[model samples]
Target: MYTYTEFDEAFVRNRVAQFRGQVNRRLDGSLTEDEFKPLRLMNGLYLQLHAYMLRVAIPYGTLNSGQMRQLAYLADKWDKGYGHFTTRQNIQYNWPKLGDVPDMLDALADVGMHAIQTSGNTIRNVTADHFAGAAADEIEDPRPVAELLRQWSTDHPEFQFLPRKFKIAVTGSPTDRAVTKAHDIGLRMVRNAAGEPGFEVIVGGGLGRTPMIGKVINEFLPKADLLPYCEAIVATYNLLGRRDNKYKARIKITVHENGLDTFRELVDARFAEIRGEFSGVDQKILAGIEAQFAPPPLRQAETTSFEVRYAADPVFRSWADTNLSAHKSADHAIVTVSIKKQGQTPGDATSDQMRLLADIAATHAYDELRISHEQNVILPHVHKSDLPAIYDALASVELATANVGLVSDIIACPGMDYCALATARSIPVAQTIATRFDELKLEHEIGPLKIKISGCINACGHHHVGHIGILGLDRAGVENYQITLGGDGTETAVIGERTGPGFAYDEIVPAIERLIGAYLNIRQSDDETFIETYRRLGMEPFKDALYGESARSGRAHAA
Candidate 1:
């Protein structure tokens, strides 16, 4: 993880102090809510439907044990006793009092974290693959570049008031664990003919009212040119992007309205003009950031304990099979501690749970931790020998659900439970679905399934990319859910197609169960995942099952 430099520390402290003054003014009634809205939003504060919510940025989703403990402290001392780790890899505190926000910001600054740009129409958190450094398939660790982007984008004057909020994601692997194609700017590390490590720069990809798979603008952007090239892209979007309708303000719409070829030409022209501005200072800073992310030393250890436990304990074996990923070091494994335990709020971790994770990371994970976009806590470099101990500690806290990539392991936003924009309740729906599936004990048999739920069209829950996506909406003042099948957020990214009509809130869970049942029936084998089956059979079989044969045939396809 990158250690904060003096400049970084001072920058955050200054922002906190400024926000404190702004909060005082609002509290004193010197600034009306109208006047204070932008001020508060600039610092990552939001006026939710019920209360003030603060989203603290976790840049590149990398932090240390101490930082994680500080987050727990903020959760307990300021707002609720838990924080919601969001899809952007940040944490959101839902019930903060307005007056207490500055103190919370102060606490965050003390640990080199803040909420700056987390809410504003500025460059949001620059997220990277959670398993960046440790993933066995990585071309390189993408965090250094992500960090460099974070530093560059922070308080950038030109980008401060873009057409809309911008998001960028980076991944160093061929397998897109970071959901790069779903970001406004997706940078995938690749090698040139000379084996030189560079990036395949993608632009205009996003999920929301208008979901789009980003198109590649530059096939191989040299490492030296990344900063300037990105600046050029955002600069181009800032100028050409729509401002009339908020719904069409995203770069995706801009790219769609004006073809990618036209947009690329503009970006290329902008790149030429500003390319000279970057010079080599960015490279020098990146070098320093790269040093901070040097992989933690790993020592070889015997795996007899892990082997014996796997053979003797089915529980531990189940958890291992589902939650663990291969690490670059053969002796190590990437442990994704499931925060989406059955019947709990997905992405939520209590103070005690947070502290335990901090302790676990300190002891076994080289003092490093990661917040995955899938709403899970990751101990990216745990030795295989330490798996049993970590599992037991997690199990004691209800965080040891072996449901990673399983149906019960869901990706859901706070939805109507917290978000003001939510049209229907996502938490309870997710909870019911998870509990129902757990009761049936069909998760293991179902294999890998991505069930993402969004309470609204904003796509905060990322329902657009789930292999099985459920979108909550209000139809005639009633909670209704529309299902989208085969949406995937991967290297092979595809926006899900909506299954005709919508189900009431009561019917949503059973509707999903029926969809899964359809999968089981159509699949050649259990090994054929939900996505694989959907790809093989198209939407007909599932559509037929979802709405019987008559309803399926009568349903008119919407373009």
Candidate 2:
């Protein structure tokens, strides 16, 4: 984790002071609700359906024990007893009093954290692979580049008020865990012909009402040209992107309206115009940032204990199988603590659970923690020998659900329950699906599956990328659900295809069950996952299973 310098500290403190005054003014009637709206949004505060929600940025999803403890403290003291981790790897407190938000901001600042750029049209928190530093297959840690972007974009005058919110994601691994293709700007670290580490820059990708997999604008962007090139892209978008309609304001829309070739030409021209402005300053800063992210000390440890435990305990084995990933070090393992427990809100973590994770990280995980876009917590550097103890500690807090990539491990946005933009409920549907899957004891059998749900087309839950995507909608004053299949959020990014008509809220769980049941029967073998079968066989069979033979035949006849 990059420690905040004196300048960083001073800047955050000043911002906090400014926001505190704004909050005071709003409370004292000096500012109307409309007047306060943008100000509050700029500071990561949202007036939701029920209460104010505060979103705090966990930059690149990295945190230490102290920071985690502070988040836990804020959740317990000011808001509800739990906090919601979001798909952007940030955390949200759904029930905070308007007046207490300043205090919350101050408390966050105390731990070198803040809510700045967590909302609004400014560059939101720059995200990266949660397994960046620890993944075995990474060419380089992406966090340094992510941090460089965060520093460069924070309060950049040119981009402070863009046409719409901008998101950037970076991944150093060949396997794209960060959903890089679905971001406004995606950087996949790759070695060029000369074997120099550089980025394959993908632009214009986003998930919302119009979901798109980003197009590769630059096949090989030199490592040194990152900052200026990014500036060129954003600056071009700022000038060309739509301002008249919020619905079409995003850069993705701009890219869609103008052909990619034309957009590339514009970006190239802009890059040439402003590339001199950088003058190697950002590269220098990037070098310094890279130093801060060096891998932690590797300690040689025996994995015999872990092996013995795995052989002895079926329960521990189940959790380990789903929750652990390969680590860069032979003796270490990356542990993903599933926040999506069966029957619980997908990403809700109680204060105690947060504290417990903090303690576990401090003791067993080299004091490093990561929040995944999948709404899970990760201990990225746990020694294999510590697996049993860590598992036991996590189990105590009900964080030991062994469904990391399974059906029960879902990604859900704060839908109608909290979000003002949501037209239908998302959390309950996620909860019901997970609970039903768990009841069936079919999660493990189903193999790796990603089920993402969004309350609306905003796609905050990234339903567009899930293997089985569910979108909740309001139809004629009633909640309805829509399903999409074969969506993938990986190196081979593809938007999901919708399956026929929407289902009623009560019918959703059974519909999902029917779809999964159909998959199990139709798959080539148990080893062929839902996504594989969907990719090979396509949607016709799945549709038949979901809507039944009569309905499918009728729809075909109608078609």
Candidate 3:
């Protein structure tokens, strides 16, 4: 949570004022819808299926209590009494009025936030690992570099109008939680032979209609060279990326068309050309940014209460087992508050829930919160001693779902429910799956399953990388759901393979059930997770479960 500097404050306020004027012009009919579209998109306003949506940037997915409270207030006042946390670690207000958007922007500026660079063919929000500073396996916190990129790329004149929207993600840990390999640029922190931590710069990674894992263009880049090296990559893409067709306009396609060797050569040449223009000023700034992320002071405290509760309360035990993660510090634990409760929307948090989260952050968790790419809120630094009380408070707000990596912890996009780009509905599908799994009582037993659903090919829900990837398509005026198996989003990233054909809306859930049931039978043991089982056995068993006569015979025999 870096507070805004004087320059940052002034810049955001000025942008809000400019947008206020643009909104007024549109209101007064001086600008038409087509004319206002691009201007408004630059500021993160989208014309969705039902109404205007405002996406607020959460840089590196970090938030302070005040900012979170303000978000709750905005949700209560402007739109409905809720906000949707997105896959990019941003929040979207889906029912914003055209005239009310300026006021919303001004409100966000009061707490060091805005919607700039969130949309419209530019470098979007710089996302990082949700458990960045706290993760036990981290080489170093990557948020400082993410913040530096945010400053460098925001309103950078050269990249403002690239061929398509660009995304960048950074992660400090060997385990990739930020979906780094699926961004335009993925920076994974690594230790060099000299034992100094640097970055493994990955280029041309993206997911949409075309999903591809990023390539390692640089085996190791010094910490000081991150910005310039990134600049070279984007600059190279801007020149060579296809603009003829929207589908082929992403950097992934550009890199595919040009080949990695040619792309690397071009980037290196550009890095040589523009490297001197940066000097050491960016590193100096990064030093200042690093100071802002100092770990919170934790006093020595007994974990007796937490241990006692874990033993006595099955409910609390279930939550602790699933929702908590290893922190670098013994006293602290990373708590992922699951917004995806059974039968609920995956990422939608009510104003009451948001306020409760903010209060808990302020009171116990060092006033810090994080939004995960999986669309869950994070209390990144809570003392283990305080787990019981925090769990109680979260339960009061219906957030203690205890299904962090379980089947119920699904990632889904707005889809046809609100997004005009969607060909099918994703919300109800997610809800049904979550609820169905819960009713079956097989969710926890299934073990570490990631089910991601996207309304369309844009992969907003990261369906391309889910262990069970569900993509909704419009097939001859019918809603057909396609399934992809063995997709992964971690260090070894892979796009899923599609099953033969799509299922009608009603058949999708049953198909998923059969697939999972088949997995349960085929797995070596309870410890064998869905992903490991898939890799070992391949997609044949799952395909048979979904579309084969043998699966039908098995089900009929069981009946």
Candidate 4:
């Protein structure tokens, strides 16, 4: 919600013009695909499986109604009829013409949004908690800091071309909703022993060929030192991060090789030298950004008896149980609009649905909306009394699925369907899993289970963090899938271990059903979730169920 200043406006305008010229050259054969690749990547354009995809950054996943409407406009006017909200809380338009991207950038800029730094080796969109400001459990709102990072990292001369793409995520809540440990740089807003809010800075965590949870670089980094410390970390990575091999280029490799103590020393040495340079500039910028995020005024009234409403309507009660969260205010609740329908691509929202959400946000939910890392949309501050109206509006648009935190509410990426890098179709696999579970009526019975799918090992779908993780792979030109068990995305985060042999494209769904069925049979009580049961009796049983006879074969094809 940060308003663009004159400086910000000028910068985006220049970027748009530059990209326009680049697109013109590409169209007229002045620039070949080889020449235009980096330029387009810098502008957040990618040549995907079918067409060019434009990834627009929704910084910190914060957007107003105007910006949402603009995204809807772009989806309707330029790209396909819908957009895909990503795990990073950004949006990808899968069918934008090369020439019209400049116009799309213009449309975004008109609403104070842009695609800059949404991709490439530079720092990607800074992500944070979707319920940052509105959550009752937050220590402080993290968007101001996320916004500050956005400004500081934009075309930063030193970090424009790092060894690999860098990601940073911040969260102010005790509950780790942002999955901070799975990012390149994780900032957990914490209160120091002195009771002053600072950050617990974690460095070098990432997922790919070599997954690592970040180590704490600094236990308590003062709020004022955020920019300088971050710069120091990026500078250190730029200088020492691996460039010899693309596979080993992430900061995780560097941190892992150098050891945390040595890396911390280097970052501290760099921080000491640059700390003075950031003295007043960041304070001024952060103050301005914080002002933009001031909470909307709420009318003083007695809290609604939401329990009474729940007792009356079973459907509403089911939805309220799954879709709503306790708000900071007494009479309000945070509503998560599940994009994971029973049998649809995860995170796909049609243009009309987007427009409808924008309208509803403006009318009933404080004109603010958030794109969550779970591939869902959030009405972050909805009054309890308005649930029925919001639910009706969202239901009409196919956004009111009551499956939040359920097994069927999976997170997946645009796999072979859109991503050129993908070797398998992740969306369809996720859809089939959801549909099968719904058919069995086993989702609610199974309780909270995170089933995340990644098209490839890049782990954009966060398969590494799911309670039940699925990884799509290519085996001898055929699509295959692997499953991992005991993974968790929480304060106590842990990477899952592979169950056994990979499943063929056709065999993956039934294999998943088999695993879930095994969990249900082995669970001591119906109250035992998949995660709890997994913790109680490791992955041995699930592995046996998934690979009944060929448990020791370790083949790519299940049968």
Candidate 5:
């Protein structure tokens, strides 16, 4: 993790003081709600439907035991007893008082964390793969570049007031764990023919009312030109992007309105002009950042206990099979502590659970923790010898779920529950689906399925990229659930296709059940995952399953 210097500490403290003064002015009636809205947003505070929500950024999803403990403390002391981990790999407190947010910021600053640029139209948190340095197949660790971008974008004068919010993500592995395709600027670390590390820059990707997969603006941009190229892209968008309508204000909209070739030409021209301005300063910073992220020391340990437990205890075996990912080191495994336990909120972790996770990370996981974009906390480098102990500790806290990529492991947005922009409740729907699937005991059978639900078109839950995407809508004051099939957030990214008319809120779980059942029956073999089956056999079969023969005919006639 990148440690903050004395200058960084001073900068955060100054920002906190400024925000405190602004908050006092609002409380004293000097600034109305309208006048205070931008200020609060700049500080990552939002007034939700019933309470104030504070979003704290976890840059590149990396954290240490101390930072995790601070988050747990804040959850217990300042807000509700739990906090929600969001799809952006950030943590959100749904019920923070306006008066106490400054203290919250101060607490975050104490742990070398902050909520700055978490909201607003500026470049937000620079996210990377949760397994950035630990992934076995990574070309190189992406966090160094991610940190460089973070330092450059944070409080960049030219980009503070863009037409719409911009997001950037980086991934080092060939597999797209970061959902790079759905970001404003997605950088995939790739090696050129000459064996030089560079970025495959994709631009204009976004998901909201209008969803799009980013276009490859530059097939390969040298690592040294990263900052300048990124600046050029943002500058072009700043000048060309729409400001008249908030709906079309995103860079995705800009790219859609202008052809990719034209946009690429503009970006190339801009890059040419600004490329000289960087004189290798960003790369120098990146070198320093890379030194800070070197992998922790590995301890030699026996895995006989882990093997014995796996063989003797079916429960432990199930959890291990589901929760573990391959690590770069032979004796190490990446453990995902699933927050999506059955019937609970998808990403809500209690204060005690958070503290337990912190303890586990500190004691066993090299004191390193990662918040995954899938709403799970990751111990990126856990030795095989420590699996049983870690699992025991997690089980004692009721955190051992034995469901990581199964149907029960869903991604859900805080819909009508906390968000003012939501039209329907997403958490309840997610809970019901998970509980229903768990009751049927078919999660393992329905393997590697991603069911993402979003309350509205903002796509916070990334519904547009799930294998089974569910979008909640308001239909004449009633909740309507729309389903999209075959969507994926991987390297082969594709926006899901909608399956005819939507079901009511009550019918959604059953509809999902019917769809999965249909998939099981129609699939060629058990090995064929839901996404593979959807790809092998397109939307027609799923559509038939969702809307039966008569309903399909009625819909055809209506059309």
Candidate 6:
């Protein structure tokens, strides 16, 4: 984890002071709610259904044990005793007092964290792979680069007010866990044909009312020019992106109108001009940043004992099987603390749970934790020998839910409950689906399936990429649900296609159950996962089942 320097420390302290003054003004009527809304939102404070919601930036979803403890403290003392971990690797408190937000910000600042850039139409938090350091096939950990971008983009004067919120994701592993294809700017760390480290830069890929996969602007850009090239891309978007219509203001729209070839030409032209001027500065900053991310010293020890323990403890074995990923070092493993409890909201972690996670991280995980895009916490570098002990502690905290990569482990967005833009509820939908799957006891049997739910077309839940995607919509003042199939959020990413007509809110769970049942019956074998079966058989069967007797009769007659 990158520690905040004196400069960074002071900057955050001053920002807290600044926001405190703004809050005071708003409370005293010196500033109207209309005037204060944007300012408050910019600081991650949102006026929600019944109260204000405060979103805290987790900075590429990496946090130390101490920081995690601080987050727990904030949840316990300020808002409710629980915090919701979001899809972007951040956390949200749904019921924070407007006046207390500054105090909360101060508390976060004390722990080398803040809420800056968590909201509003500016560059949002930069996300990266949760398995960055531990993944076996990574070129290099992407967090250090993500951290560099975080530092440079914080209150970046040039990008303070962009056309709309911009999101950037980086992935070093070929697996694409970061969902880089769906971001405004996606960077895939790659090696050139000549065998040199660089980035395959993709731009204008985004999801919203309109979803488009990013196009590669540069097939290969050297590592040294990473920052400068990114700066140029964002700068181009900043200057040329639309500002008149909020709906059409994103860079994706700009790319859609301009075409990729012309956009590439413009970006190339801009990159050539700015490369020399700030390339040196980027290098200097990255050098400092790299020093911050140097690996912690590890004591080499055997982990064969863990494999033996796994054979003995069924609970530990199931947890180890579902939640653990192999690490680059044979002595260690990546342990994901599942926040997806069977019936609770997929990502809600109580204050006590957060504190326990922090303690667990400090004790057995090298004091490091990461929040995954799938709405789970990760202990990135745990020694395999410590697996049993770590598993025991996490089980005590209710963080040992063995549903990772399973059907009950859902990714969802905060819908009508908190987001003003949302029309229907997403969390409840996810909850119902999870409950239904758990009841069936068919989750593991379904194999690795991704079910993502977005409150609206914005796709905040990344519903567009789920193996079975559900989108919540408000139709004629009634809640309606839309389903999409064949989506995959991985190295072989593909946008899902909408099934038949949208189902009413009450019909959603049954519809999902029917689709899954259809899959089970038609699959070639139990060995085939839902995604694999869907891909092998296509949407005709699933669509036939989903559309009820009408489609069934149509298929029968046609046959």
Better TM-score candidate (1, 4): 1
Per-residue accuracy of model 1 over 1-559 as CA lDDT, tens digit each? 8878898898888888888898999999999999999999999999998999999999989989999999999999987799999999999998999999999998988888889999878999999999999999999999999999999999999999999999999999999998999989999999999999999999989999889999999999999999999999999999999889988999999999999999999999999999998789999999999998899989788988899999999999999999999999888999999998899999999999999999999998899999999999999999899888999999999999999999988999889988889999999999999998888888898899999999999999899999999999988899999999989899999999999999999888877877887788778986889899999989988888778964344422210
Better of 2 and 4 by lDDT: 2
Give the clashing pairs for model 1.
Answer: none
Whose TM-score is greatest here?
A: 3
Model 2 residue-pair collision total: 0
| TM-scores of all predicted structures | 0.98, 0.98, 0.99, 0.97, 0.98, 0.97
Worst ten in a row by lDDT for model 4? 550-559
Give candidate 1's TM-score. Answer: 0.98
Q: Give the best candidate by lDDT.
A: 3
Per-residue alpha-carbon lDDT of model 4 for 1-559, expressed as tens digits?
Answer: 7889999999999999999999999999999999999999999999998999999999999888988989999999998789999999999999999989999999999998899988899999999999988899999989999999999999999999999999999998888889899889999999988889999999888887788888889999999999999999999999999989999999999999999999999999999999998767899989988998888886554445555667888988889899999889978999999998899999999989999999999998889999999989999988887888888788898888889999889999898888998888899999988888788777788888899999998787888888888899999999989888888767687888888779999988878777777887899998998899999998888878876675334432211
For candidate 6, write residues 135-197 as lDDT tens digits: 988998888899989988999999989999999999998779998988899999899788787
- Per-residue alpha-carbon lDDT of model 5 for 1-559, expressed as tens digits? 7999898999999999999999999999999999999999999999999999999999999999999999999999998889999888999999999999999999999999999999999999999999989999999999989999999999999999999999999999889999999999999988899998899999989899999999999988998898999999999999999999999999999998998999999999999998888888777888888899999999998899899999999999999999999999989999999998899999999999999999999999999999999999999999999999999999998899999999988999999988999999999999999998888888998788999999998989899999999999999999999999989898899999999898999888878888888888888988999999999989988888778874333322111
TM-score of 5: 0.98
lDDT, candidate 2, at 4: 94
The global Cα lDDT (0 to 1) of model 1 is: 0.92
Which residue pairs clash within candidate 4? none
Off by over 4 Å in 1: 549-559
Scanning candidate 5 in windows of ten residues, the lowest lDDT window is: 550-559
Q: Kindly list the per-residue Cα lDDT of model 2 for residues 227-274, writing each as its tens digit.
A: 999999999999999999999999889999998999999999999999
Candidate ordering by lDDT (highest first): 3, 5, 2, 1, 4, 6
Candidate 2 residues lying further than 4 Å off, grouped into runs, are 549-559
Stretches off by above 4 angstroms in model 4 are 302-308, 549-559
lDDT of each: 0.92, 0.92, 0.93, 0.89, 0.93, 0.87
| RMSD list, candidates in order | 3.0, 2.7, 1.2, 2.7, 2.9, 2.6
